[model samples]
Target: MTKIFFLGECMVELRELDDATMGQSFAGDVYNSAVYMKRCYPKLAVAMITAIGRDRLSEKMLSRFNSEDLDTQFVFQHPSKVSGMYFIETDSAGERRFTYWRNDSAAKKVVQFLNDDVVEQLTSADMLFFSGIPLAIIEQDSRVAFWQKLEHLKLAGVKLVFDPNYRAQLWANKADAIEQFNKAFQISDIALPGIEDLNVLYGISSAAEAIDFFQQYQLEELVIKDGPKSVVTLTGTDLQSHKIIPVTNVVDTTSAGDAFNGVYLGARLSGRTVSEAVQLGAKAAGTVIQHPGAIAPLAAFKQAMSEAGL
Candidate 1:
């Protein structure tokens, strides 16, 4: 089995259900992608490297991970801090607005638990996936330890996959986000970057411009995503364009990109060609956007994958 580790946070997610109620669940950027990928291909070893509290909410979060059948061996328990929570509001267009309360969340301390044994386990894994969220939240005091661990993974030849899921609010300034994103690209073997993230970080708008912007990196595989537009990729020096079949009714656009990242990487790791993988990823994202919330229902996702012959 090909083992992969996803390092990030999972928060208690609350979304308004009706005028008088709110629906609760567990989700975050990297965790959402990990869940979708693991569900599509259960044989892959998917471990989440994050920290949670010992409280009841944290326990429920643990149960959710268990229910997803994700490998929880790397989930650390924080001594005092509790898990984070966010409330989501969706508009008529299925666009989302978020309110977060994660300043002192347990995941911010995850770097503290990256001891020698954990490093060995990560080194042994085939790939490690993470996003800008972890890069933004890791405490300034613990960044040295975090960078050292990344260095270890690089030296051990672990395939580093990165997505710059940039949120301007999470970063103190654009320069710091740029610095971290630069380092991440330097070490990554595969990169999936959204045009929106690039627009925010580097003023990049289209996939063509994105390609020109990323030409400086030593990236082996680069996939540039433009919402509801053609997905573009650069394999070594060859660039290809894959059209995204549009979805007429958009219920929620929450995890569309994450869905693409998960299935695209999953398909590639399963020996599918880049073209096939991109089609399957488009299928995954299209199916996800037709549903509500970050995670679409399991049965629906499976049926969609089966229908697509993924």
Candidate 2:
């Protein structure tokens, strides 16, 4: 079985759609990926590593994780730190914008709880997944410790998948964010970056430029997403492009990229080729934008999977 470990925060999500209706859900980059990964590949062993509080909302998130049959044995529950929260507002065309309230989230301290056993768990996993936000949220020492541990895991042959989900508000300045984001890319075996993120972080003009820049790191597989345009990927010396599958009606695009990363990696882990994986990723993302929340209903996702032959 493919065992994957995802390290990041899962927060309480409040979404306001085009219809002006509001609803609450749970999401974070790695957490959303974990859910979609588990759902798409039930045989794969998936676990999330993060810190949460002992609050009611925290308990509810755990229950939701359990319902999806995700393994939480590696999760940490902090004594005092509270979970983070974010609010989403979507435009009529289904594009999303976020406002966060996560300055003091419990996940920032996750590295402090890491021990020898935790290191062992991560090193033995088939893959370790994280994003730039997770690294940016923590303290200097914690970030250092976390990167060292990840380096050790890489030496043990655990693949690293990184998403440079750059949020400018999370960092002290643009230069700091660029430095750390590049640092993460160097260690990443697979990179999933949005075109907008690259523009925000590196001032890149287009997806091709983003791919060319990251190609310097010699990533094993690179996928660059440009909303409603096309996805650019590089496998070895062969660069390919796939057009975005059209969404009939885009209701909200809150988790479009996260959902794509999840299904794409899930398919790849299940022995599909890079092209096949991205196809599934595109389909999953297209379906997600047609819904109102980060996680569309299980039935809706399954339907999309079936239609896409995922």
Going through the candidates in the order shown, the clash numbers are 0, 0
Q: For candidate 2, give the lDDT.
A: 0.86
In model 1, what lDDT does residue 224 have? 92
Task: Flag clash pairs in model 2.
Answer: none
Residue-level lDDT of model 2, residues 167-189, one tens digit each, is 87888999988888888999999
Question: How high is the CA lDDT of each candidate model?
Answer: 0.91, 0.86
Off by over 4 Å in 2: 16-22
Error (Å) of candidate 1 at residue 132 is 0.6
* C-alpha lDDT (0 to 100) for residue 270 of candidate 2: 93
- TM-scores of the candidates in the order shown: 0.98, 0.95
**lDDT tens string, model 1, 1-310?**
8988999999999998899998999889889889988988888988899999999999999999999999999999998998999998888888899999998799999999999888987898888999999999989898778878988998898999999999889888999999999989988889999999999889998999999988898899999999888889999978999988899889989999989998888888889999999999999999998998899999999999999995
Q: Which candidate is the best by lDDT?
A: 1
Q: After superposition, how far is residue 199 of candidate 2 from its true place, in Å?
A: 1.2
